[model samples]
Target: MTVENALAGLAEQGWVAEAEADEAVSRRVGRPARRFRFRAEAGCMLGFDIGLHKVLAIVADLRGQVLGTRRTAVTPALPAEERLAAARRLGHCTLRSAGLTAQDVRGVGVGTTGVVAADGTVTRSDLLPDWTGTDLVTAFTEPFDAPVMAGNDARLAALAEHWRGAAAGTEDVLYIHVGRRISSGLLIGGKVHTGRHGAAGELGVLPSSRWDTAPGRLLAHWADPQTLFAAAGAGEAKALAALEDFADDLAQGVAAMTLTLDPELVAVGGGLSRAGRLITDPLSRRLAELCLFPVPVAASQLGDEAVALGGIRLALNAVERELFDVNG
Candidate 1:
């Protein structure tokens, strides 16, 4: 059956349609269906991450318990379609290793880095240069006949940190995903607040004095902010200066966000975040200097897996139609 039919089968099997927990509840209801008699059955959700070097897929049950996971390196020289086809096969193998089949998968969620359009198009991925404008929804949904969901990896990492990891129990939170580039995600009132155009968290585009506009691309790379921090950790004085300046700039960005949204906490993640005090300590002090509210900053609990886990969380909640609005 196709994904639409699978969802219909779910309803036909007596599963109640619940509002997305991430969205506000409505008093309005759809036409009630005649109660069908069917016992509850165990099912699974698959969370997949397509990255520059490797593809990671995680499998979990309705309750969010992880069952199995698989990862494989990719040959970057290949075309986008070939890479996607490889991902599909890897996903199938991942499920097979978990003793399940594609039909048994209720939903699949993907988290990829870079600009994700509203209609499920992944534009400008740093890892997979060829994947720009790739329609991931069609790629997974057509063949597997299962509902597929996709989002920015950093955004979902922020969601996962809020829901099941470090930022758990917070109502308003911020997560800065630091890597080759820096991006951020926000959870306000416990829901991921992606702005209009689906580009709110693209911090790399945020202006910074450290960047050079002459070459154009130089400005983009310098504005990332994380590069400075990484440089500092690598023992470069010039880079450290850039990082300190970037920290001040980051304070400005964080301050603006705090003034507007007033998040209760902020957490840092990604490969660069592992540097710890080289980044967080200065960041905390700067945030204090810039903001009126005194919210604490911490590191991500799940590290690199945060985004993948967030994908799993997204799928599980969607399949079970459970409340997913809150951070914890």
Candidate 2:
């Protein structure tokens, strides 16, 4: 009975094909044993990183292999509506580049710079106030025919790190993101720990953490962050001292989380992670003094693509549900 339903669902659904019947196998089992092959191209998933400075879109197959990708520059001042339009256009372009269509997208997942609600709405966004109240589901719905969901960019980056990046095998991780924004996300028991309001790992919002404005202090010695980090890498006096101080500031909030949550590992991601040792080294040293027990600090292997890939991971999750759900 179960075999009949399995064949009917898989074959009729067009995601799998039945094997040829063998009389020898029938004689051995008293019935035909069927084998099926997974159709990797049967459907695709769309993932997007709608960030403060850019919008990134990635197209992937059921197997999580990235097929095509596109990104567009945006700004914090760019109106929310304009940014949404640019992102949607990128989605269309990315799908076309992959030789796929909107109908082929089984699910769409987004990582954006703000607090995402259960209904995929941005309830609050300190970086982009105009983005608040935007319905992310509706934002992508016009561009594709599929289920859509959105998550906080940093949180999703944590998911990506656990999926294939720095914290891949670690079950408990504290993912710290320091870019245009400073935030963190948690993976407890190998799962993305989105709190009750989808704001669990948000350490910047606290007044004492001072993470929201610490970048200003870090930039006091140099006008541009990239230039300052480069100088620090070369062992420049002012840049090094300033970065050390900044590292101390960054570690303060991280220590708070470490003492409380006691994550197994700490991952530093986002654009600043491109600085590599320039950022992670000082952060590691400061965390050593601040944390009760030593916690490993690692730079992101995925670099700028972490959040975009996390978006892909999320979309694949949704696709798997649709593809594997016999009842649905």
Which model scores highest in TM-score?
2
Write candidate 1's Cα lDDT for 232-324 as tens digits: 778888766655655565566666766667788888887756667776777788888888877788888887778778888767657655422
lDDT for each candidate structure: 0.72, 0.86
Clash pairs, model 1 backbone? 163-327
The sequence of per-residue lDDT tens digits that candidate 2 reaches over residues 1-328 is: 8877877787787777766665564356465466677777888889999988899999999888999989999988999999999999999999999999998988898999878987899999988999999999998877798889789988889999999999989999999998766899888998888888888878898878978878778876676788987898888998888877777888989999988889889999987677777778899898888878999899999887888889889888877776666672
lDDT of 1 at 98: 85
Error of 2 at 115 (Å): 1.1
- TM per prediction: 0.73, 0.91
lDDT of 1 at 303: 75
Residue 131 displacement (Å), model 1: 2.1
